[model samples]
Target: MERPELPLPQLHAFVVLAEELHFGHAATRLGIAQPPLSQQIRRLEDKVGYALFTREPGRIGLTPAGRELLPAARHALTDLADGLTAARQVGSGRAGRLRIGFAASVALTVLPGLLRTFRGRFPAVDLDIREMTTAPQLAALREGSIDIGLLREPPAHDTELGFETVLDEPFVAVLSASHPLATQRAVRVEQLANCPFVLLPRTVGPSLYDQITNLCIAAGFTPQVTQHAVEWQTVCALVETGLGVSLAPESIRRIRLKGVAFRRIEPNAARTRVAVAWRKSDSNPLVPRLRAAFDQDPPDGPRRRPNQ
Candidate 1:
């Protein structure tokens, strides 16, 4: 058996004829002359190798084949229309998937609120989020594995990417609730000189890692590196087990993780200047909308400079 290829125009004509059950009415519905409509129906019937409709002098009725094809034809037309709509939406960035990589600290910061706002404005943009440290995020961006990255500033020379700063947050001390400093209202950089420190690896987020150590060195002692983790929550988790103290952005306190107490650090100008990073040549239009979403006010407070 061979399948007859139905052209779209012919399919449309058949569907209209099936609904109207008369050549004149179907022609009127299609805004065409009855003679032309009749000619089109005859051509379709010839190709189909059977009469789709039994045409009497004044009335027309669908044959068994026409009835079966009516539903299939209607479904095919609907599918085609929907597919075209989807194509249009995707082309305009009104609907599509955006893969984004973020550091875990972002969970406690402005990223969530930024995402909510983006969704509110563009509900059709699907977000694919991955929690990665700054270093991995850089690699991901260069590899085109992610559309954007929410992370702190990279070193001056990692210039293969573009970036937009979302917020500048101050760093604070994060210690286990059971640790001695948990009772204190705040801790100083010098005070932590000799304590075992749980830190994010330098390979992951060099900026913050150097900031914590440099601040400690300036305060008079090098920290004893006791543990390292990439994700902020994991770093906090190790602290919960009383592994060591860690320096984190002030926004991290919002995580509300049990067994951890966050204290403001003194005399140290340490802070995490978080930014959204992407490939320099990346052309996904969704990226701009996302940046616009993040450009809004920081969720927790008034706008502050990097030092704030």
Candidate 2:
């Protein structure tokens, strides 16, 4: 037998009648008269070539066909309603998922607090987060894999990406407790020239590594780089073992390594800034909510600039 085409309005009428099990209440719920509601159901049954409901003198009950069709009818109506609601939300700039990428270092500081606040305010919005380095995050944002990025510094890639400062933090020197300079009130970049250093790999971000190295040169000598670690924690861990000293942003203190002691790097030579970045051409309605996550007031004083 050929399958009959099911019209949406008739399907809607069938769903209501199935739930009510009576013509009068179903008509009340549908805002129509009982006779018209019955007429619509008869037309639906004729189209399907089967009696959906068995009507007795004072009672009505679903036939086998009605029972079988009930679930599909409910599902179709529900899916249609959900699709309409989603479309309306997008049209009004109120719904949809937003993918955000972040560097591991930034995740330790402003990202957590900002996420807590955003989750509370926009509970309906779906958020997807990806952990990535600054370079990869920039690439993902440009390629549309991500909508926003919490990056250490603004990318030097292209003018199509927009950056907004979220946090400005100064780099601090981390050394083992047994290191001689650990007891100093505050150490300058020049003072650490002779100490062995655990540096970030040149491949991680060459320009950033150069910025750290150049700061040492400005203090009058090249650093004695003993080892290179890819991530900040790895470098700091090596420092904790008394292998060498390292320069890291203040956010690294949150790690709380047992043997590590953090102190201000005098002259603020290696201070770094973090920002929320996104594509310049993106016009997604959720942009404002994502931006609100990091839109706190700037702290008073001279803010730190990026290495570049």
Candidate 3:
């Protein structure tokens, strides 16, 4: 059988009375009149189904039942107080769990600094960080699996999500260390017309995939894509093996493969943007807070929409 629910006020009164063992002193400690304190103890005992105190002329003491209930009631009250404190901290955005999904490429650029700033400001917030590609990161944000997304080339029009540009970086040509163009201070996009290309499949990142292809077209030749790799590092590795040359974000140069060389694209008008993305309908307070971390702006900073 289930025990009756005990009122918090009654339990509080009972604990105070048990500690003082004197109605006058207990009432004083609880800031209540003696009669009401006694009445609360009686109500708690009724719920507990036991006599909680023994009373005699000029003397008062706890019965065995009262002694047993004291420790449990004290522990319950302590736990409740701790839980309330934690909830308040979370409500104020000072402490809580924030799940962030980020592109692997940004880990080479913005991710580290963003994390450092957020951790410094909100030391109590627990972070669940996952490395994901643009497509998966967007999916996770919509599904509520991640609170924030740091990704490349967020879609230009997505009513379901809000985005802000965090970094705008130019593309660079990646070549094998021994390739002829590797020693060039800068390479024009059109110079690679005859070279077979290694590229990321459009399925993984449509915007970025199209950006590269469109840059090639603007240079007057559609890249003859000969191989596909999902990650920038893999693309660089393929270039290193002389499988094909590629173009990637300037951040890709940080991968540091000894056999790979990165050269600036002359007239580097084609730039890639990394953005912070979140569901527009998201109610998590941490979402806005984290987005600010991405921009190194205050939480109230001006909002930048996708593709801006």
Clashes found in each candidate (C-alpha, N, C closer than 3 A): 0, 0, 0
Tens-digit lDDT track for model 2 on 50-107? 9999999878999999999999999998999999999888755577888989888887
**Quick one: best TM-score, which candidate?**
3
> What tens digits encode model 3's per-residue C-alpha lDDT throughout 4-84?
998889988888888888999999999989999988988888888889999999999889998899999999899889999
| Residue 235 lDDT (model 2) | 87
Model 1: per-residue lDDT, tens digit, 45-110? 888888899888988899998888889889989999999998888778788899999888877777
Candidate 2: C-alpha RMSD to true structure equals 3.7
lDDT against true structure, model 2: 0.81
Candidate 3: 10-residue stretch with minimal lDDT: 297-306
- Minimal lDDT window, size 10, model 2: 299-308
Off by over 4 Å in 1: 155-160, 177-184, 257-259, 295-297, 301-308
Give the number of colliding residue pairs in candidate 1. Answer: 0
Q: C-alpha displacement of 240 in model 1, angstroms?
A: 4.2
Q: In candidate 1, which residue pairs clash? A: none
